[model samples]
Target: MAVKSKSVASKIVLTALVLVAIFPIFWVFLNSFKQLVDIVSTTPKFIFTPTLDNYIYVLGRDNVQHGLFNSIIIAGLSVLIGAVLGIPAAYAVARYPNRFSDDIQFFVLSLRFLPPVAVAIPLIAIWLDLGLYDTRTALVITYTLLTMSTIIWLAIPAFSRVPREIEEAAIVDGYGPYAVFFKVALPVAAKSLIGAVIFSFILVWNEFLIALMLTTSDAKTLPIIASEFTLLGRNVPWGILNASVIVLSLPPLIFVGVMSGFINSALKKKD
Candidate 1:
């Protein structure tokens, strides 16, 4: 009876947490289908005629498309760059556990806690001096700092989880370090690496502060573009804004669904 009660309690907690996480997103989705009048009504209306005008207007804008394209490019490239650099660095730190490695790990982890404004303030000055401000390249570089730090830190545990014996055996079999990493260590740690990639992609996709400061027009992202709906005039276009939010959120949702198995598997495995 106690066990059953505990199980029920756990389920209730999980359900509540899920609802809390999903409610805002569901509200925004509902707003997206509503008319401007319906959205801004004094009281929330559960029953209302849905329309496609909000979506139509949001999608027809060239800035929306441009911002989305930039978001995709920036997030995708940031994750790619993060993976390329982080995987090797993580492997090194895991392989060599010493003072130097400890220092590197501390530095990498420290980046995660650093405030965005702290990094963004100096980055703006440096970017301006280098003539890279307001460019995709600048955003890409700035976002790499965000994604790469996360990748390197998260990937450490994944690499550490890989058995050293397997790597040693591969080396004895005449496989080079590169081959062992690609064939043996990587395969063993692929689940965690995939998790890192997924997380990094989401973080980069939703990042706004640096993009807002650095990008004026050319490199503006979906979040930046969505935010502009509020800044257009005194009255916020809630319907159009919600439509943009829904559109912007779809890719991350789809990516997570596609990678759910990997994420679940990684979570189940001991680190």
Candidate 2:
């Protein structure tokens, strides 16, 4: 009975920790449903009626359809580039763990540490000179570099965790290196690869800094559009702002929830 009590206590504490971690997301969601008068109210308004007015206003905007389209296009293209580049690169690194491969992994990770703002200046200049400024291609190339580093980082582990003996056995049975990689290694690591790609998609989708600077009116993203609310007058359209934010936030949230479930199921199946 005493041991059972200890386990219960532990569960309670863990539950509290999880709630703390998720509180900010909960706060955003709760406020998104509240009316503007209640959103920043001095007193908490948890008991108030919820409204979809904010969401309707944001989604109903003129350029929003275009922005949404652009976001989907850029994010999808970025994921494709990351998968193409990172998968082979990671497979090579895992298959041959030489100093060069290790250095390559290290170099890929180094890209993350570089500030976006610092890179954006030169990138903007180069894009302008190349006549690629404010174009979808610019977004694609930058997002490729932005997302692929992390995707490669995640892919390397998935590849390395697969036993080399499995690949060797397949190769010995007449399968080529590529066949062994695709037929054996990738099938097993599909869950991790899928999870990593989903994560990369979320990162590119939510990215603001590069998108803000790289894209003007022609190719502005959701995040960039969200920032436009702040430039409004004092009596701002609160409903529209909150509505826009909620919609903007939904894609990544749903992506994580759906992909996480699949990943969990995949891991269970593997077990």
Candidate 3:
């Protein structure tokens, strides 16, 4: 009877915690249906007619659709570049585990500590001088700079999870080092790679400062578009602004859900 009571108490606490975490998302969803006037009104109107005008307003904008496409391309390429560079570095670090690997790891993490404005000043000037400003390439390169190290960091522990003896046994069977990596290590660490790709994509997609400085028109992204929500002369379309943000952010939220599934499956393996 005591144990049953404890279990029920625990369930209640867990349910409460879950509700608390989800309340903010519920609030945003409700607010998305509200007009700007209703949104600003002090009294909460829980049961009102839902409208789609905010969505229409957002979709009617000139470059919002195009900017979403640009955001996807830039984020996709960043994840690709990060994966290409990060995996090899992680493999070497896992396989080598020496001073050179340690130094490189430190250098990569150090990039995170530097303030954004400090880096942007020189980066923008350099890109402008080279005629690379306002281009997709600038975003890709900057994102790679920001995201690759994180992938490597995530991948290293997963790589280490593979038994060294298993790799040596592959080597003894006449497979080359590269073959062992592709055939042996990669399969074991597949979940981590997926996690890294999702994380890197999210990082580049939400990147604001560098995208603001480097790209103006040809490669503007959703973050840049979201910044233009307020018109100086007109009252801010708070409803449409929030709706655009909600829509623009949906893809990343979906990615995170998919990642959660991967994590669940990976944990099921228990190896």
Residue pairs with clashing backbones, model 3: none
* TM-score for predicted model 3 compared with the true structure: 0.86
Candidates' TM-scores? Answer: 0.87, 0.85, 0.86
Residue 104, model 1: lDDT of 93
Candidate 1 residues 1-271, lDDT tens each? 9999999999999999999999889999998999989988999887899999999999999999999899999999989998999888998888877779888988998888888988888988999999999899998988898888899988988898888899999999999989998999999998778888888899999888889888888889999999888886788888998999899889889876646875676567564
Please, what are the lDDT tens digits per residue for candidate 2 over residues 92-192? 88887887986898899899999999988898999999999998889999889977898888888788778778888898999988898889999987877
Model 2 alpha-carbon miss at residue 203, Å: 1.6
Ordered list by lDDT, greatest first: 1, 2, 3
Angstrom error at residue 164, model 3: 2.3
* lDDT for each candidate structure: 0.89, 0.84, 0.83
CA lDDT, candidate 1, residue 239: 92
Q: Candidate 3 lDDT, tens digit per residue, 152-197?
A: 8778867887878899999999999899999988987787778877
Q: In terms of TM-score, which candidate is stronger, 1 or 2?
A: 1
Better lDDT candidate (1, 2):
1
Evaluate model 1: give its lDDT: 0.89
